[model samples]
Target chain A: MDVLKGAVDFVQNKTKVEVNQRDIEKILSALNSTNHFWEVIFLSQKPFAVVRETINYLISIDFVKTDESGNLILTEKGKEFISANNIPVVKNYTCSCCEGRGIVFSEIKDAYEKFKEIVKTRPDAIVEYDQGYVTEETAYSRIALMIKKGDLVGKRLIVFGDDDLVSIAAALTKLPKEVIVLEIDKRLVDFINQAAKEHNLNLKAIEYDFRNKLPDDFVKSFDTFTIDPPETIEALDLCFTRTISSLKGAGCAGYFGLTNIEASLSKWYEFQKLLLNKFNAVITDIIENFNHYVNWNYLLPSLESSFAFVNVQPKLNWYTSSMYRIELVKDVDIKNEYINCELYIDKEAILYKEN
Target chain B: MDVLKGAVDFVQNKTKVEVNQRDIEKILSALNSTNHFWEVIFLSQKPFAVVRETINYLISIDFVKTDESGNLILTEKGKEFISANNIPVVKNYTCSCCEGRGIVFSEIKDAYEKFKEIVKTRPDAIVEYDQGYVTEETAYSRIALMIKKGDLVGKRLIVFGDDDLVSIAAALTKLPKEVIVLEIDKRLVDFINQAAKEHNLNLKAIEYDFRNKLPDDFVKSFDTFTIDPPETIEALDLCFTRTISSLKGAGCAGYFGLTNIEASLSKWYEFQKLLLNKFNAVITDIIENFNHYVNWNYLLPSLESSFAFVNVQPKLNWYTSSMYRIELVKDVDIKNEYINCELYIDKEAILYKEN
Candidate 1:
């Protein structure tokens, strides 16, 4: 099959990234054993772009094909190639209880129950704002993780977005000195504020877009900040610059959620470098598949280009993001300045069209 | 109190590391709230060196003092500095159940039970060999975590040391293609080899030290490797060079445990940079306080040099290490070389005497 040469050729022809045969072979080995598109990212640890590019290359060479039901299937040629290479299929071994997060909500059972009850009236996610709320368990788990890290409780916390109403969950503990949420959706803002007042919690919500600079009083004033940032490189840059700018100074903490389904590991690599090199931050924790979201309605045939590859519905809530906790070792230099490192764009959507 | 100038002078006179006002202030603020040497690192997110230096400086000026019971106390002047600053005393909010590890042994109940039973007869730790084993729960948790990461099943695995017997636990699962342990202590080697025979497992142990060059056949031969390395910078560099050299190529994984009590954040920063810049490895998971070690006898009267700060014995097993999982994105260049990376040194021991 000359798979090595074929993969090398495909990388040079189709992508800007320099593809390594070993990485490609690794992904190919994992894919050869799976027929579920939903499980592709879970199967291989390679970057999202490389996996997608490899699958695309396989499709181009008539080696693998997507079923009408959204499942993956190897073509006869692909089967032959895999057999010739003697690739063994490895079973997925992630723990089913914690879902590979290595954490559960046992310690925060009361908060889990409370968040679950309060989120019943939470606003629905809208495609316009690129919003998707996490499960209530995830919401409470985030609160628990922060408290465990000593970033919560008697600390001033700022949440970048409240789509998940994580701010409300944190305030429920009545531990933090204050809880402030800057969200673009007025519905969520009003809902969170209503909840805060009714519960008499030290929390408030302000309707704010992340692209705009934070107010002077808000900048450099928080002990910790949390956000589910957009996946695009530009948007991620802007979102982080704005959110991180709110930190009082060094020893401050920030929480972020990055997804494997949308953001490639290359994007993760870039963001990680940005955190360490530019911001002088040390990443303390990253738990994979930690933030599992409620399946939103945006991808149900409404998003034609994205859903085209998946002709049918996914059986599970597969949109999960890794949770990150980072501490700034140096003060951010810029504050109260308009920040959009560049215009935020959704390149994955662009890839959808091109592919 | 002129605490700012005090810290500035202290940094200049006491340490080689760069000191920033914001970082020192953050540490001071968090420290003003607590008095336990064990709690110092957890109180603030600053690097270990800065935290240590700040505390030492406080003692120099009679701002902080140690109680005979080992608790930290503020001198009359230190009390004045804190009151003038109005620094809030933040309560420790770590989850009591998980102890901030996030994951419990709920899912691996059977494996947890089995590992606990088997490790009962394991070799006792000897400080001369830098040996201290983790709790049974921690040993099983490492196995479960690796399985959750999809790095165990049908993959060749290697262990740099066997003091923890994590290799034995993985062999218990009967999942890996092969499990090999390179350990320095023959007691551990014989014990693990004996366990392999009794359990009918595909695992073998060889009495090997990390400073020696890896055998040719062992180089670039494994899919995954795990270790609890010595925390000195030189030891860390050499140990990583040897263990990482055993990986097959890109997509290979490594697991390591780094203790906060021994290694400072500055060392952590340097090691992290080595992983990213030198080897092109991507860190996927890092959970703090994930490895809780059993209290060994070495810290009693036998280790007076390190225990000088504490007159009384500890009430709990305060020694813990963070767990890390990293994946290689590129192949390592060197193989089978006597790699000392500058003869392995333990400067922390020297610091104990000098301080």
Candidate 2:
């Protein structure tokens, strides 16, 4: 289920006109009759009391406002908010099966309840685990840690995937003063927009696939980038290169790596090598076995090479599975630094100074 | 750049070998020589000094020990410590380029000079940010987190990837644990094995592909499972389902969602719904945008329903691009467990039970 934040934003930012209680009620009535709203309500088939409570909640949240003519109009703030945030405004559509009640509309509620209970009782003892994706929680903590470290504030950011945790984190953390979310899925663009509106978060969700050329607006518009492209290393490589081209001097980037599984080891290594060749970022942090089921690592690296100058550092975080958090920074000149000392318990610490 | 923890665990659990300085050195030497090590070192060449310092610091942590035979080994206490804690033994390899100098042979001195300059300016930046598949520091933290969470205790864990983070996390976290790492790259497998021998970790690195059926021995032999399969979600799903079949009742599993900007909003919804339907798990947490450069999301869900008759509360930690932390715990049976009370602040203090 989608969060109501987008809807809230839409109402708050879009509707310019004032709204009253009567207008609110009319909107509620209209919503109740809408195919989309009816479908959801019917499917949930929660008590009418719950539905009424939800309606009241919507009104209380200012998602619906009244006009001077006593008619319900989405506030200008709400409309602007929705448009800016990319929240979906569903049009007329009806459920073919349940009509609006959402329920199957059959007399099998008891049977359905019984079946659900039975299913709930049967424990799914199977545990299938794979290393491909990282957990959302780990992703958030990693970013939070970066913020805590002061690595991600006010940076021009470009994201390669719009549907995953990375996009959500960007929307929530407010790391990049400006964030451009690029996705190939139109539906995801719509969904992300909707979600953004609900939360009143301002982000640019662009519809573009990595396999194709990047949007013209994104040429060299970012100092930091993240490439969590599709699994095909080739695809990842292409996306990484494109992102690199758009990165300013000293820009950094992060990418996901394959775990140490027998099946993925070779490709994982190859992917790593490819990244090194394309970017001058340092591998700073990693999340090991993030989800208990997926044994994958995230490579956080910063850009620091003559080819594409960017000073960066990597960040790491881990969770249950072999998941990793990698962070990279951009534009570091590596010609003046040196190891100052070596510490050994028995021997005096040795110091080396740069000449 | 695999962690030494996996090797440490293998030696401690699978064999009766004691790990000492020599063993540690050997593992380190092997790691230094591996392509993975070289990759990391090469990527972070600018921060060579810092990387060297970090490595030395980790070696001095006291958790790593060397044997009289000059083989790096965990002390008896160390073995007991890791085993008791269920930490995976990681295998460290030596650098091949500069014979552990962490420099490319041709430009050893020049690289070192360059490294000093870079680190001096950005002392806080991690040097080996993009080396190998993962980093050692991240691996250790991941393992420690798992041990703290009680997920690694006496669990039969299977890891699909073999990066430093996974190996180290598995080796360093928890005791009395069994771990199997699957890899497809033969070179890495060899490097990992050598590292495992040197560190005395009880981990076995195998070679296999998920496109083919899983090995027979892996059918139903695990308590906890981790898979970081290749990027294909379908492949990841199949691998997860197959692995889940092997887990015991109530066993926990984690998976990463392969996300990208090309992801359709509908697909994102469908992916979550699919997880809920197949696993009957409560999506407890998520990590939003990891970086503005990638659109990835991590989903953490607890298994519920009756398929396995086990009431499993799955905890999830997600890392996102934007560095936002989104933590969620499954709220189950709240009505039956707690009473809500309301308090008034205006007049005399008053309390009222909710519902």
Taking the tens digit of each residue's C-alpha lDDT, what string does model 2 give over B21-114? 2233333332233323222223222122222222333346553343333233444544454444333222212212212111111212342233
Q: Give the alpha carbon lDDT tens digit for every residue of A23-130 in model 2.
A: 232233334333233232232222222222344455555654533432334545445544453333222222223211111212223322332332232211111111
Over the stretch A18-129, how does candidate 1's per-residue lDDT look in tens digits? 4555556666667776776545655665444456667777888888888777677888998888776655464444555555555555755776677778888777788777
DockQ of each: 0.25, 0.01
Q: Indicate the TM-score of model 1.
A: 0.81
- Tell me the tens digit of each residue's lDDT in model 1 across B213-317: 897889999989999988877888788888789998866889989875666555676777777777777787887778888878775555443433443465566
For model 1 the interface RMSD, in Å, equals: 4.9
The TM-scores, one per candidate, come to: 0.81, 0.28
Kindly report, for each predicted structure in the order presented, the TM-score of its chain A compared with the true chain A: 0.88, 0.44
lDDT against the true structure, each candidate: 0.73, 0.36
Runs in model 1 lying further than 4 Å from the true structure: A1-36, A39-118, A186-201, A305-309, A339-351, B1-121, B190-201, B206-209, B305-309, B341-351
